[model samples]
Target: MANATRSGNYPPLKNTEHDHAIGPLRTVELHPERRRNTRRFGICGRIAAYLMSIALAAALLPTPIGSETAHANGACRTDDHGIRLTADATGESPHFTSIQFLSASTGRAAGNGFMLGTSDAGCRWQPIYRGKLTFAQMDFVTNSLGYVLAGTSPEGPAMLLRTANGGSSYSPVPNGGNRFARIDFRTATEGFGFTFNDSGAHYTANGGAKWSKLPTPPNTRGLRFFTLEDGWAVTLAPGGYLVKRTTDGGRTWTTRLKASSAVGVGGAVYGAGGRDVWVLLYGGSGMSQTSYSLFHTKDGGASWKQVVSNATAGGGPAPGPAVKAGKLPGPAGRPADMATPDSRAAYLLAGSGAMDKLSLGRTMNGGKTWRNGAAAPGFEGKLTFPAAKSGWLAVTSLTSPAVYATRDGGATWSKTFAIPAD
Candidate 1:
């Protein structure tokens, strides 16, 4: 059933009518004339928002932002040392997809026309809220408190916003009709969210006001919780399904491991601390090729292993043919599908139709072996680092959508903005 939209919300036209029809609804109606020409370029837009806030003030100024003065307001790029900024929460252009940071100056960014903030990090990006939804996901545990998760429109009601001050202002965390796809918080009260159908899982210890539903195990699609007890949940059954665990926060949950019936776990599930976790499976279902696995566990969820396996496994990369030049393959064609770690080193973005690849794997000698770095440009959606050497790697371009950055971790990259081909 799980598919309603007559006011029950959950209708972003069934996921934006196949590829965001009409460019994210005309970029959310030209975002108030692009915020009145960025406040009439007041003081040169405040010196380009203070040189893009020196790349989130680089963990407290140790001297960064040098790579020919970092620049790319369209097709993103920033890595001469790394520091690229672009937030167009609806200013006619600059459509930041998803970004989150609790430090490095404080951060928050959502796309399609509203939800921006920057305590001095990205130089200056102001806008606290705007309705009509399109926020994909965001989570912060301190700095003030956070949560975003949006995609509403059966009429309304499918949000989850919350901010205790760090974001300036944000409220609305009722969500009884349940439609969240991803959300994870470890402190600031306690958190965990999931609902793609298989209908189960949702909890709040006070930060979200009130919520409770935990049980999830029936056809569970995907979920990853880092704290609030530990966290983990996966179920689809093709080979590996069901891996629930809760130290004690969720009250009770225990099932350790069960992933290896033969291999066929979908996609999306990430973690960094709380024992370092990661999951990305694809074999069929528009993911083309056939094989692409990367499962790792440090102990939190008891156990799990299968470091890395790529080549689409037999059902992942198939649409190849129109590469008159080179590089192009993301948008589910295969290659832009994993990002979920705050440290322990983790960053993988691959797409091959138009060519966009970047990988920087590190397990601190834990996940066994995974070492590869250098490659960027060709994104699918969602990849915000914030710190760990700088972040922001959004890319979804059929014609215009870009963002990139890497300090010295992924090697060398540049280009930091682009979303105007209209």
Candidate 2:
């Protein structure tokens, strides 16, 4: 590779500066399991749980599974089946980097120190793994099969871990120091790991027990493959970002999109498959915040459309990714975080979260349109939809780290359980 720049890989697309305007201060020490593998790029290391543990004495008990009891502060609602999410292994706060739902009733959250899994909605949760380091690019292909690219660096090759027991435990997949930015599986036995550094791209025909390199675009930064062969690549340009696609795995490439100034300033690329793809661009300057641009394609990369234009704030720009096209997020925030369950459904988070209320967005018809939606108590910090209208969402705030469920799409959310913090 010629001029490759190191970005991050471990599903590590959350806030780089967790120190800015963080929630109420309460410090806690990290458990011995919290591991720091040496940050590769500019990714901030999650040293310890940001805040001390809140008084979780009342929340540790098992509440009624389906009963919702409104509590004080209008913040802490305890229902039957309520469980708590913790911040990594620190057991301090429940702030998390990634949250994914394998099914409407099953999901997981990755915090600074730990990874927790739930099956009975949010009613209860079990610790899947309690170790050091962060887990990014988390993907659960089935009820029992899952993959996470683990590392300390935000922008570099990360070690890959595989689980055959429904995220109960994860063991490293030997790629020999190969830095994988992301992992995608089209089937149970077929997958691809987009890489950084000299490893290039790889293909695993037998689940990830072994990997083989594929011919990939040089200096590729981000990889989003809809299938084993069909995918999109986010690379670097002189001024902004570059987009590429491959129909035959990484064996070939084609230029499909380009932005001199934006798709978004800090925006990213997301895809549901060959026909549905999105590029979020940031058009803001360095000083103040600005609105973002969303360029989407429902026809592979053959053509692109601008569904969302930019919105500004206070003569500057909004501080985060807000959905200005509708009233879902109001004017407080934009769509900063995104998760696409399929080409028809995509979820967006309203704020740069720590531990508070955030709005949510959902589009049921590709990226052509969106609807104002919300979750109970708080918005989703991390989300996943294993099936249409069937998803598990985790709201990892400092106050109450919990998961919720949406059955008839994202219109209504019910509490599953709360994540336990230290």
Candidate 3:
């Protein structure tokens, strides 16, 4: 199962003017009574002391704060964002690690041993399933059909659950001895179950009732399919990474792109219909910062152009290309979560770590122009947008278990719902 508490660390900010790190400054005495020296001063000495006090007070003035959140009465408030979606729904609270929406009003949220369904844009959520199983992966081919991969541990014999009434209930599907680490559906009745590592895969044509062995390219990480016969995969090549395309349902493959910097596909491949597709590629190590590249293809991977690339260390493609010269936004730290609602619109939550403040980068013209804005504190984990202007963010902090929503393309957000108490 996915852990919602997983977060990236924010890098220390640089104060270019002072050539120092930006953080809490040394405490200064502003009140006259708090002064340590008790000796009375002469006329000239009093003037000097008064000037020094003025300088210190000027230094203590607060900087301009971001409009994303506010601090009042010793608490962070999001009142300016909007009204809450609804009061907290009562139920057994499960730590939600992932949330997906079919439309503005229909969706599902899942975590360890539980899943909840909302039909009215999170105004009300009903418990759909509860058990001693961790939902590792979830996919829905339609509003009334979906699947969840569950297992006792992160790795092992996973059980498949199928829901046909919009996640109102689920039933077990026979596994047929196929140990799958993940599953992706290209249609309601056709899908592929991928095993751990690039071992191979299992093919099912009748809604996962039975399966047969399917061959996979070496070092295959995962698969994204637009149809049963048209899909894409990224594999570990000898020198770097290789983007492969398959038109025969994984029966055959073709090399589409080769890169030494990109480690692999970063997140979900989004598209408008099946003609235009966009994917994010990222690489780098924990010890060093990494850059992400966004690629676009309007002819279904026939041709691709790198529209946006983040800057890396040493001015080289640390993982991707160097930042476009004044053409797009620069690095906002590693991409923690991203949502591409369509071919022309995308949102990226960029930050370094879980504790660091995250910035929201939005592009409405296919990465042509990006407006980077501030995100609310503790807004991390899975991010999704059912529409270009409607988005949801699940707060990963255990102490702040709430979900946020955006209606203005992530310019602002409001607390929409909260995980109920046990």
Candidate 4:
């Protein structure tokens, strides 16, 4: 459990080496862009997971100008990450994917069908439930109580919703035909649901209505569970991609690490417990040489290292003081979005890089050391911090829907509304 420690990558100094008048490179890197279920890896793997979720949601869309989004006139200075995060409230269909926050006041944002919320730290936002369901999974352990999982299609009637006052209203847990691609609940009724491509991950003690089948390890994408027995999952095999753990709820499992320098893996996997886990692995040499890094695990997730890196697979982990792969822009400088509330304060987002701007990185004392934060625009999704100053950043592209807030942990951010229309 101690055989990883390599680090190298600090590159970022092109485009005429800055000074194009003074500022224009906010840790640029954007373009780099999940899970599981039941026991039916059948019907041709559910028609190849419904054509791989329409090419994996178009390969997880969002590559507009620099990747999450870009477009600013400019104003707020002091290292203007691009002066983003705006809204009196407007949306034709800007779009949002998923966002969750049970504290730092409260939170919710779901994609497509629209769901909205906030409670103070975010200034003031309302509207709780609106329908047709386009959510991909929303969670809450407090702030009223919550759980959502609508937006389904892969041959079956899927829907799982429940709200105890927060979302204002919701009721649908007849999740019997379970088409779960992702779901989690350590309480609020003790729950868990998963799928990497077709139905086969379950364990529900009532809150989710009903479910059973559990034992899974093959290709499971991001099955979470922080307590009620502990949990974690991530696998791809065939030459590297594993990461597993289970304390009892999932029956039995262990593996904890094996990225093999990864080529892809993104959706959701971050932690502040169980030895403090975190995951973000992506690599590319085609489509214009992309890159990404940031892996860590204390002892519960077996073994891992590479606290952060850029391209060329960068040396092996834990070496520090490195950067260069276009000199940190994002979209390839990869740090799409991340937030850790413990193990020593954390938050990272470099979305819309390549020049559109938006870079915010902070680490109180965890990832060695980092600073430069405060920027906004969109593209970053789900970055929550329930305390330690309080945080929340959930944005979607096409014009950057909205939902941002930070009391101090993330330097600064505001918005906290807009995202309802279409």
Candidate 5:
């Protein structure tokens, strides 16, 4: 993709000298007409030039995945037991990026400033809390306790909100300077939060009451804590990202393997035990295109084998003769490239492009084979599996995005009508 320009309109860096300056100072001064010409042609022209460069980049880069290749065949088919979904309460907009079910009867959904809850198997919904914060990720150790992490902008601080009485109320936690991207709880009393900061992992042993920082290896971007003692951290490197395992809690970690890397690692990391772990990789090779891959570690990242590659499954019709595979592109700019595979079962949501079109895939006996699920109407933002047989999908359509649920895997789906179109 084209490189975003480093222009004055962008937010200033926090530690830079310009951040300390009291009053506005001219970096460059020009006459009125000259300034007009510069504004019209300088930044705007540069942006347009960048777009052209990206188009060229896409043309030069190898096709990450054969666009024409059909979905892999021979994978186990999910039973057709249609799921029955009761229209639970909806939020300000039907666009929900995160959903968690503390149990079969209690759950919460979040997007934008709204958080909604259900108590009767999604039969009815109620507004729990509405604030200015836009939650990007959340996790629940139990129905009564959970945490939500919000993305930070210049207008406000990145927030860590906690609720002790289920979804009845929420209060902000004192996280100091860290901005968390992912949070996981091993138990109601022990939890961990991973941040984009280079410092390390921010952990809490006494629930969310107190937190301590741990030094993370360089280039670490994502983390998954299965239990207080058993967890994994994924770090980006030259070729792919590395997986580190911790058995004695987060006190120390051991390197497993530098799993296959692409532009960047997207989606959630799930571990069945100390022996099994899975991750999703996304983005293109510095080109403005898209590709998706999944990795599996049977012995805790000591070694990894690609369960799915750019190769089309089922040996189906070639997508116009495979374009020669070239070096994978660098990171393409986008969030929600991949969704966490289902913890109870190995399933993931992978999407590409501005449209965010999603494909659902599942691995039954580990990542040995993958079966394609039903096609989503639009971009699939998050996949929440309250039970192994029952799953919920949050997606964005052209007109009105909605949350859908499947009781029998992805065979059939039902929408929650209570969700608003905001």
Candidate 6:
């Protein structure tokens, strides 16, 4: 038999079982025994044998089993059953980057290349969207109205896509905004958009139907808005990070607290409601061995106190291919997150060693006191606490990405859903 060598004439094929089987058949004409047999059979017989071999090889080619319906133009179309992925989805485990809960029983999730919706909290999920676009952030003003930031590839110019029927379908918002790294909507008509490395922001007063440029301070890392004119943001300062408040909207900012540290890199802000809020500071110089500080304020940034002085954040960014074979993948993009249920209760998840090696911390008395909560298994992705005692967590793994619920704060947890690749 002739040795088979792939050429550059066609797209590279994966080394799947079908490839191994079809490879030799395609190159059979080069074999010494087959060449002699072809000469003895004459041209007509040779043609007959060649036709049979072609039929045999065609039968071995794998057929796609995806449930996605085809459009008239041959593009895959999405339906109630989202785009189904093949067995080999990607090189690593599926990683869910963000989760948005509209109510106690309904929510949506965005991951590497897909989005999911759950009507029974995190107990069950339905694939709502799938494609090659990378989801950066998502915001839902109601059960049936939402927005998402996505781009064609990882190096993104994350534009806006609006959904009206609870993400069943989406359409691009005309001149809505572009390259917005994060978006927060305080009401159906009041929303804000911020960029990671720029000075100008965008705001909408009519539920994203139109957008207007809102000048902002440079180097803003995190933001949480309470109203169109009132909000809090974390900005890069000379020493470390500055927690600033903008009562006149983004036009002006007042430093509420200065988190000065030798290793302070950036920070994120989270709000419970009314006057309760938490600020998580990321402190580290490298991707490994991250350290964090948690601050709390009961009077809406009027006064701030450090509740947790120092805690170890195990990882920085998502690990590279050097990670051990079976180890869980790490979280990417945003490093830490906080869920505030009330004026005196909040749960914070931050990187422990890897980006998703998360540790849970709970504070029941606003920010006056905090305690460690039971850590759920797998890499923690996002947290949503609807009440002081009822909360849901999204956890990611290699084979199955799941959702876990906690009824008594974060003291205990139970698996609710293990999302299968569909």
Return the top candidate by TM-score: 6
- Model 6 TM-score? 0.67
Instruction: Identify the leading candidate in terms of lDDT.
Output: 3
Better of 2 and 6 by lDDT: 6
Better of 4 and 6 by TM-score: 6
Give the Cα RMSD of candidate 6: 20.6
Tens digit of per-residue lDDT, candidate 4, span 151-180: 433233446777655554456675557567
**lDDT of all predictions:** 0.50, 0.55, 0.58, 0.54, 0.51, 0.58
lDDT of 1 at 114: 52
- After superposing candidate 5 on the true structure, give the runs of residues whose Cα lies further than 4 Å from its correct spot: 1-94, 151-156, 197-199, 248-253, 259-268, 283-289, 311-344, 353-356, 418-422
Q: Give per-residue lDDT, candidate 5, residue 3.
A: 15
All models, RMSD in angstroms: 19.2, 13.2, 21.6, 19.4, 21.0, 20.6
TM-score of each: 0.30, 0.65, 0.66, 0.29, 0.64, 0.67
lDDT tens digits, residues 45-91, model 5? 65654454344223222223422122246231121112222222333
Single out the weakest 10-residue window by summed lDDT for candidate 2. Answer: 1-10
Model 2 lDDT per residue over 121-210, tens place: 544555665556576657877666677776543333466777655553456676645677667776776787766422256788876667
Give me the runs in candidate 3 sitting further than 4 Å from their true place: 1-94, 141-144, 153-158, 165-169, 197-201, 212-215, 262-268, 272-275, 287-289, 311-316, 324-333, 350-359, 420-422
State the TM-score for model 5.
0.64
Candidate 2 to truth, TM: 0.65
| lDDT: worst 10-residue window of model 5 | 16-25
Task: Give the CA lDDT, 0 to 100, for residue 322 in model 1.
Answer: 16
Q: Give the range where candidate 1 is weakest over 10 consecutive residues by summed lDDT.
A: 1-10
Provide the lDDT at 266 for model 3. Answer: 32
Provide the clashing-pair count of each candidate structure: 47, 51, 6, 39, 12, 9
Q: Using TM-score as the measure, what is the rank order of every candidate, best first?
A: 6, 3, 2, 5, 1, 4
Sort the predicted structures by lDDT, highest score first.
Answer: 3, 6, 2, 4, 5, 1
Model 1: how large is the Cα RMSD against the reference? 19.2
Q: Give the C-alpha lDDT of model 3.
A: 0.58
| Residue 22 in candidate 3, Cα distance off native in Å | 30
